[model samples]
Target: MSTYAIGDIQGCYEPFRRLLDKIHFDPVKDTLWIAGDLVNRGPGSLEVMRFLFSIRDSVIAVLGNHDLHLLGVAYANRKPGKQDTLTDILLADDREELLTWLRHLKIMHSDAKLGYAMTHAGIPPQWSLTEAAGYARELEAALRSDQFPVFLKDMYGNQPDCWHESLSGTDRLRIITNYFTRMRFCRADGTLDLITKDSANEAPEGFIPWFAHPHRKTVNDQILFGHWAALEGKTDTPQVYALDTGCVWGGQLTAMRLEDKQIFSCGCDDV
Candidate 1:
């Protein structure tokens, strides 16, 4: 039984299916860990969700920013933007079942057996694997609770600057969620810098890509993530994998077999 980790599909269902076919993934035996962003910004959000649900028993996925946004949109009655391909998901006949599945996904997974910690965004410098997992669990509980919609309505912000045990309510949860879901670049002191999404060279004076920080706390655990598509699949360490190579933007969709380190990829079609 092999374990395969796939990068963000972002609603690109054809490439997703083709990549699985290329890898010959067996739902009955093999397991798949998705690096999230499973739906949004591409042509087949609903198709991807449905297909993934069909194989849910064998999949482990951490929720990404887009995935959270999908929930936010759903709870808040927000309409899809022009660039978003969320219409299919919002109009799906089995939308409740899909949303329920999405809500239960975690933000971090550290499989001692696999020797890796999987998240959509890298773990922050301030958090150990244990701490990160705890934070993720806390937010997961809140998101799945009846208070979820209230939390979602107030969840879009970047205050409290850094992780602090003292911060409470939605502010505390949002901080942790952003670090594990939306973070890309950060200040050297480890504060989330949410504004810039540009080439690495163009990062404003104090910002550096989150994983490139000198004092990363989860370094001892192999951290595998996506979400920073502009990085184009690069990490300073072989232990850390950045597999989102903009597959939804006509790049390659990739999967790596965790047991044998075997790699599989499929060329994406133009959306």
Candidate 2:
């Protein structure tokens, strides 16, 4: 059985399906690791959710920032943004089922046997793999609890841009969430620059792509992530893989086979 890690689908269901077909995916034998942003921005959010839900046993997914925003809108009564295309999901008959499944997805996933660790975005420089896993569990527990809506209400923000062991409550959760989902550029010391969405080379003066941080503890671990579509599936760092190819933005949908690292793609011009 093979394992494939796919980039953000972002509601581009047609392209996503085509890419899966291109890889000749076999649900019974193949395991699919999704890098997240499973819904939003593009068309077919409902279709994507339904398909993944049907194939839940063969799939492993993490949550992206857009996924969290959807949760906020659904549970926290936060309004959807003007550009969001999540209305279909919100209106679906199986909305609660889909959202509940999404809410339970882990923030980070790893397999020691596969020699890979994945999150929607890259892990912070300051976090050892063990620490990152622990923090992910903390946030995951809150999301799965009855107080999740309350946590969702406090989930949005850019404050406390750095990590500290002493940080508590919403502030700590928000920073941890940002590191796993919204992160792109951050300082060498692990302080996030959440505002910058430019390409890696255009990082603000004091920041660099999270994977590029010099002292990163996960440098020796194979890391798979998808948030920065600007990288178009390249990190130049041998141990870190960037999987998002901007399919929602009309670029190609991409997937990489874990065993051989062979890449597959499907154009999204009509997505």
Candidate 3:
């Protein structure tokens, strides 16, 4: 069975399906590792969720910033942003079922046997894979807990942009979530520049892309992530894959077959 890792769908269901077709995906024999941002921005958020839920057993999807925003708006009474196209999802009859599935999604996924790890954004430079995994579990626990709405209420913000082992309460959970969902450029010390959304070279002074950090702890391991669509599926670093090709922005949908590292793409003009 092949395992294919895909980039952010961002509610672009047609491109997602076409990319799957190009890869010849078999739900029963193949596994799909989605890098996140499963909903938002494009049309088809509800359809995407429903399809993924139907093939739940073969898919491993992590929660992205958009996914969390959907949850926050749904459960915490958070206001939807002006650019959001999540109204269909919010107004759907199966809204509860769809949101519940998204709520329970992981913050990170790893397979030592497959030699690959995935998160919505990317792992911070300061943390080892084990540490990142532990932090992922921590955030996942908060997301899946009864107090999830409470967590969502406090989930937004860019403060506490650096990691501290001593961090606790909402501060700890927010930073962990940011690292796994919204991260882009950061200092070697793992302090995130949460405001910048530009390409890799446009990073603010004193900062570098997370995977480009000179002393990155997990540099030797294969890591797959999305969220930085400006990257357009390119990172000069070996074994570190950026799969988000900006399908929602009229670019291509990308996927990497883990077994052989073969790349596949489908244009999103019709999306």
Candidate 4:
């Protein structure tokens, strides 16, 4: 009856399965919290989505940037790039089923009893758990609505780089999405610096990893997140877990058992 939080799959189905096996996952008793990026840039996006969907009841996942990009390309007609590997999902017979399931997925998941929270990327330092949950709900509601295409259409961009209570319309939604799915580093003032892709050691001037901000509101909450594979599951800050090990980029797939905080990995063969 253990729970495991896994990093980004990014279509690396073989490694995903191997990691699950390494953990000796029992679907009937074990629950999985996925840190998102379940598809794209690997050879098995379609298979990965289908597998996750099949065991949907045993899993909880947040949306990652690549996941949203797949949605944008599917529903909003956003153009797929050369490296995009989501065509199989879009063209699958169960495409609607899979995408709809994905659209309804949470941007954040929390369990006070378990003392952990999950997001594709770190929650911004500005908001407390309650505020972050409310904002996540707001965006999730929009995504599940008929107006979702509007969100997908307006979802791109890094503008309005700071949070504000008064933000409305696409601007508000986009910023929230950015924080949940695309953020890595930010300034002390809560201004997001989305351009820096290096590890925390090389963080640019005036900016630091979101979890490292001294005033971060959710410091008491254990956060599980992906999207920054360069961290390689390393964040010196206590209780902040970086699970993405860049499996799609020739790194390993990683998972952590929640009860004992034990880590497991499987080498990826997708290179």
- Candidate 2 residue-wise lDDT, 229-264, digit = tens: 889888888789999999989798899999999999
lDDT of 3 by residue, 130-210 (tens): 999999999999988998999999999998999999999999999998999999999999999999999999999999999
Model 1 lDDT-worst window of ten? 197-206
The 10-residue segment with the lowest total lDDT in model 3: 262-271
Cα-based TM-score, every candidate: 0.95, 0.98, 0.98, 0.98
Residue range 1-271, candidate 1, lDDT tens digits: 9999998999999999988888889999999999989999889999999999999999999999899889989987656667888877888889999999999888787799888889998888878889888988998898889889887787788786687888899789889888888888787556878888775666777788877777778666788899887877766665789878888887888898988777788889733
User: What does each candidate score in C-alpha RMSD?
Assistant: 1.6, 1.0, 1.0, 1.2
lDDT, candidate 1, equals: 0.85
lDDT of each: 0.85, 0.93, 0.94, 0.93
Q: Could you tell me the lDDT of residue 267 within candidate 3?
A: 92
Q: Flag regions of model 4 displaced more than 4 Å.
A: none
Error of 1 at 224 (Å): 0.7
Off by over 4 Å in 3: none
lDDT for model 3: 0.94
